[model samples]
Target: MARGSYGRGVTSTRTDRWLRLDGTTNTRDLGGLPTVDGGTTVRGRVLRSDNLQTLSEVDVRRLVEDLRLREVVDLRSTAEVLLEGRGPLRAVPGVRHRHFTLLPERGHHTDVFAVEEADAPELPAGWAESILPRQVAEDDQEETPAVRSYLGYLAHRPENVVAALRALAGDGSPDGGGATVVHCAAGKDRTGVVVAFALAVAGVPDEEIVADYALTAEVIDDLVAKLASSPTYAEDMQRRDVASHTPRAETMRRLLELLHERHGGPRGWLTVHGFGPGEQDALRARLRDQQPG
Candidate 1:
């Protein structure tokens, strides 16, 4: 709410963990969240955000200099990246950028339009009736369209998902010392799913993961408004009511439940998808704070 300078050149306000930036609406530190084993996630290690295409110089300084960000895991499709171009962070020295889109690389799935549909107010016409009936029949109809979309990320481009996790696990970092920001458009669906899996691998509790995903709702209006002003996402944002953009906790909860039901858990899913135990441990080590003896 309050708009003041938070640090050095960062002209933004702080709303709890949310980093109020001049360009982005839903950027927050994934720190101090409780894990199942009595540990908490360490601050400055990971952050989740919406688009960074419009980040001001001050915002860039805050993320790179102040937060010591070393990596950015961009989850947007190839078309989204080509259309939007890399943002300000791309030119900054020492910050690595990796694009691991969680969508099919070809056919009907390789465009910004299809990426937008992942979080559309409703499933595209007949989508639920056609592609998702098997999941519905198998999962007792517990999957919301949003949940199904999230699961589709696993089914569609699981390698990208695992690659994103590996990037977050300090793959390119000097010693896993700097922060990594994971983001997609609006930072609600793709970013949320990836962050959820990262936190799950870090041993964060299910409720905390869901609560973190739902935090996007607090800034849903601003997020939608910001994207609506952008030419690339304007049409999609204009078509959907703002309420439809607000993420529901139950959607994330069910996603996690189904992940466990079908794949043992996030860790198991990652393992099955080729992430392996060593990589999972590295990711866990990168995300979790050391518990006191």
Candidate 2:
């Protein structure tokens, strides 16, 4: 667990992949991912992370000075932020913070699972029971936990989800900026979906997207423990085993397909949701780097 070392088990050649912040294990740069057009994602432009509430003084300096972070797209619900208050980064002058609740207030904690329980009647008895704070009587159907959770994101709050991307693509920060950090409480579920879409739009292939999504798995145990330690996520943790909460690559894979089949892929979905030609071009320019010769 050296600084910049992303734990022991996982391996990658992504040179700037993990940020190694003292407060969070899940922070990573969405850079150096291979795009379909033979280019790579621009290094230091987009970073994703869990909560920043505990970022050490050194961590804040690294983000501001080292990473040149300018915009922070916070995807947590109003309740989550109000409960946690502003993290250290909130008061910083150089960084611009934007709050876009990816989930409606009603669906903040239990309501997300409530929607999942209703739509996913096929979960195994024990898992379905564990779906919410209370047990859900199971039916004989099957869906992975990651897929179910993603579906809940789409089902519950698709509008804010699209808006979050649009904000990341634009340059309307307190300071005009491109280096944006997208994050939620854990930076796994809601942040994963939004970042997945951003990468897809940048022409990063499906496999790479899945790899980035699955990277969260490496730190799942520690993330769960961190969440469980807080009252904000304690009840959510009590709902299931930590293993069930770990992310799987296939979860993102299936979600990509769902976007393709249902919303006509990333470009079409964004277009339909009002990310017009101007915004699209701006986003690509902001994220895409020239192909290394």
Candidate 3:
């Protein structure tokens, strides 16, 4: 599965640059997103994670120097920063850290993909069970707070999304144009949407962009397991299929379909968010198979 050998394929030439301790299980280098263009994202150039609050010393070393990540962006909400503290990025010396909150008032669900409990065929409509649909559902949010909030973020918060793209592309950073990463709580929905947009901008086909999108469920099976056993968890996953725990494949597919149907694919979506040709190009530069970095 992609989780086991994530960066291994690209790391033979490079080292474990983005590998970090204290980061969430879903955190990993986006360099593995295979492209028709031949190369993948350069290792250490960009990474995604829940929050760097608990990053260990080794994690710091990998991020600060090994990855040489020049920029660190916090896509979490303001409350999250207060609770989690993105922490002064010690690794990756002089790493220009920035905070661009995507969902400021609402606390982002950190582990929506923790599907271990979703193993239960009829999991209760608890907060824990809301991760996937809240993100990918096409229905309007009338009763479900999680669903409403997540969907509202997408429809109303184009600015944050745009800012995120600009940041990932380093629209105004000092990295001199290089690799970048984006993530929100689970690194599935918000992060996935952004990455798909970048990939679409890079001329990657929807089939592959979706392939990359579907991989997040596999990325965090362990966390879902943990959440399942803990009494703190809302429901028991009860051994259902793996895909059931994350956003339903059909749910995600429908969201992509909506993006295409409404905005004419990723580019049109970006344009609706006010992404001009220049910003679109910036996104392309960041995610498009690099010319050997």
lDDT of 1: 0.75
Q: What is the lDDT of residue 118 in candidate 3?
A: 35
The residue pairs found clashing in candidate 3 are 64-91, 64-92, 117-237, 119-237, 119-240, 120-237
**What are the TM-scores, per candidate, against the unseen true structure?**
0.81, 0.79, 0.67
Which residue ranges in model 2 land beyond 4 Å of their true spot?
1-15, 107-145, 172-178, 290-293
Ranking by lDDT, best first?
A: 1, 2, 3
lDDT of each: 0.75, 0.71, 0.54
TM-score, model 2 to reference: 0.79
Kindly list the per-residue Cα lDDT of model 2 for residues 1-293, writing each as its tens digit: 00111133332326468889889979998878877777777778888999888899999998888778877888876556656666898778878777776553432333221242344223232321322331212420255656666766665567777777877776622223647899998898899999988887777777777788888888899898888887777888879998788887778877777677777776777788777656766666668842211
Question: What does candidate 1's lDDT look like per residue over 1-293, in tens digits?
Answer: 11111123221123667887898988998877767777777778889999999999999999889999988888886656655765899889798787787765443434332344354233233221222222334554456778877887887778888888888888533238688999999898999999988888778767777778887888888889998887678888888899888899789878877777778878778888898877777887787643211
Q: Order the candidates by TM-score, highest first — what do you get?
A: 1, 2, 3
**Stretches of candidate 1 above 4 Å error?**
1-15, 107-142, 172-175, 290-293
Candidate with best lDDT: 1
Where does candidate 2 have its weakest 10-residue lDDT segment?
A: 1-10
